[model samples]
Target: MKYSSKNAQETEKLGKKLVSKLRGGETIALTGDLGSGKTVFAKGVAKALGIRKKITSPTFVLWRLYQIPKPGRIKYLCHIDLYRLTQSQDILALGINEYWQRKDTVCLIEWAEKIKRFLPRKNLFLVKFEISDLNTRKIIIDGVSDVRS
Candidate 1:
């Protein structure tokens, strides 16, 4: 657990304080690189799952679900982007393990080490961005221990 984000609106306010301690079938794997904010931390976890539209970077439409408006424990947020999918059979022909084994869903996988063997090491969560200069941003978050400020 680490964080730095001196920009992109403090990495979307640390992705809305890490989605208020998410409560859903989480996945969140996101590594970093190109532009390094990862859709501004997925538009702060799609504005804390209320998702007011406009949260781009499915990187040419690889994924993008975002629903969340019911009696919620998070209805959906998918948002995957494996940097244009070279193949892992195109991430299993785009099912993505049925949005990371949906249980009201909350996926969020940017490059995700390019589908690191199709994730799922049991609940999984790995953030890792590191630019640390042009508007800083170090963020680590492996198991996440309240991700200090």
Candidate 2:
């Protein structure tokens, strides 16, 4: 569905809420302009996964892996950023694609439009953000049931 956030905090809250239904092996494609709250939403998901480390976009290094502190079936969080790459080959060398289907890991990719063709056809979530004025955002989520529930 879709959601409107009045500010960063609200956007993050929505992110945490959306992630509650994830059980791992899920890939989330987060897309939007810079400073559109993609990273903030990711932090919310990280918080729900019991990750304590600060969450930051992997724009330079390309990807960051975090271990779920209280691991159960979901043991890892793989966060990737493709903002710096104009071509898919630049990202393929990172071998980050292997995380797409790992049962114990949840993959979140920012600027996923860079490699949309390479993503799994199923079990994927697309979170799109749009700037709505200076402190607001319109977020749309697809590929699953209503996150509002």
Candidate 3:
């Protein structure tokens, strides 16, 4: 579905709503330009997942893992940033496929266009963002998942 947000806050709210529907073993592919608010949207997802720690763009680190505490459970959220990688082999070396195989983790990949070939056809959520104005963004979300507001 398509969602329009007047500002980053609105975009994040949309992200949070989408996150509430997510289960473990899900993958979300995010594609957008620089400063398109992909990281802001991700912070919303983290919050929805009961993560209280600070969230930041993993540009320099490439990947960051967050643990969320739920009732009688712990959920793993792996956030990956592929902005600086120059080769697909770099991604492969990170053992991303291992995380993909796990049924107890959710992976959110930024700059997913860089590694599209490695992603599974099914069980993937694609979120694309475009800057419509100085403070507005047109976000398009596509997948077969149900997201409740």
Candidate 4:
């Protein structure tokens, strides 16, 4: 699906809507240029997951983990930024493979284009964002699975 956002708030709202449909073990690969509001979308997802902590870009830290409590259970959101890494082995050494191997946690990755070769062929969501203007963005979401009701 494609969504157009007039501003950061609108982009985040779209992210929240998408987050509501998310389940454990989902991996989202977010690709976009710098300043394209990728972290804004991630904040929306974090909010929908019942996380109250401040959400910040993990570009410098490489990754950040958050815990969401819902219905007496806890779920994990693993946010990763691969913009600084020059090799896939750097990711592997960080135990990123473990995140992909599990079906109980949700992983959100930024700069995903750098590691597209390592992602799974199925059950993954890829979101691409393009800056159309200073306050506008075009977001495309693909490879999302239909949730069974």
Candidate 5:
């Protein structure tokens, strides 16, 4: 489905909408340009997941793991950023692939195009973001209904 966010707040609201639908072992591939509100959307999802820590893009750290606490659909959130790595080997070296193998974790990846070849073809949500205007973002979500365990 397609969604339009007039500002960062709206973008986060869209992200929040996806949280309840996530089950463990789900991977989310997010693609967008520099200022496309990808992080904002992620923050929204984190908020809905009952995470209290500040959400930041894991560009420098490469990846960040958050516990979803108790009474949630998923136990963990593996947020990854592949923008810094150009080689697939580097991605593999960081053990990034291991996140998808966990049955109790939900992963959200930014700059997912960088590791497109490494992403799973099934049970994934591909989110594409476009800067439609100075303050508006066009978000497209695919494969949501097709997500399987």
Candidate 6:
């Protein structure tokens, strides 16, 4: 599916709406340029998961885990940033595989093209972002079809 966002807010809403159909154990692979709306979309996902603190790109720390407050199907949200890493082996060295595909967790990876082949295909949602213009983003989604408007 292809989605166009006029601004960051629209991109974020699209992310929130998409997650509404996700039960758990899903991996979202986000790919795009530095100023793309990847992190903005993630913020929407976090909000939908009931996390209100705030989420930022984990470019330095590598990854950040957000604990969902609940008795829900998803207990944790693993936000991974692969911007600093160049290969899948680096991801393995950090033991990122342990976090993905967990029954009680949802994994969202930024710069995911770096490790796309290593992710579980059956449950991975590939989201590619293309910056159309200032404040406008074109997003292409593959793998899932339940995203609502």
Clashes of 4: 0
TM-scores, all candidates, are 0.32, 0.95, 0.91, 0.90, 0.92, 0.95
Best-to-worst lDDT order: 2, 6, 5, 3, 1, 4
Q: Give per-candidate clash totals.
A: 0, 0, 0, 0, 0, 0
**lDDT of candidate 4 over 65-123, digit per residue (tens):** 88777622327888898889799768887766666635667888889898888877666
lDDT of 3: 0.82
Candidate with more favorable, higher TM-score: 1 or 2: 2
- The whole-model lDDT of each prediction reads 0.81, 0.89, 0.82, 0.80, 0.84, 0.88
Q: Which 10-residue span in candidate 2 carries the lowest summed lDDT? A: 92-101
1-149 in candidate 3: lDDT tens per residue?
88788998898898799876676778889999988889998998888888898888788779888877782232788999899988966888776666763677788988988988987777689999899889999888888453544
| Model 5, residue 128: C-alpha shift (Å) | 0.2
Best by lDDT: 2
- Candidate 1 segments exceeding 4 Å error: 1-9, 12-14, 17-35, 39-84, 93-95, 100-103, 111-133, 136-149
lDDT of 6 by residue, 33-126 (tens): 9989999999989998988878999988899999998639998999999999976778878766677799889999999988867878777888
Residue range 99-140, candidate 5, lDDT tens digits: 664778889999999888888887788999999999999899
* Candidate 3 Cα outliers beyond 4 Å, as residue runs: 71-74, 145-149
lDDT of 2 by residue, 1-149 (tens): 88889998898887788777898899999999999999999999999888999999887899999999899888999999999988886777887766766999999999988888888877899999999999989999998777768
lDDT of 5: 0.84
After TM-score superposition, the amount by which residue 39's alpha carbon in candidate 6 deviates from its true location, in angstroms, is 0.2
Clashing residue pairs for model 2: none
Residue lDDT tens for model 1, 14-62? 7777777778888888898988897898898788778888988877779
Question: What's the CA error at residue 3 for candidate 3, in Å?
Answer: 1.0
User: Rank by TM-score, descending?
Assistant: 2, 6, 5, 3, 4, 1
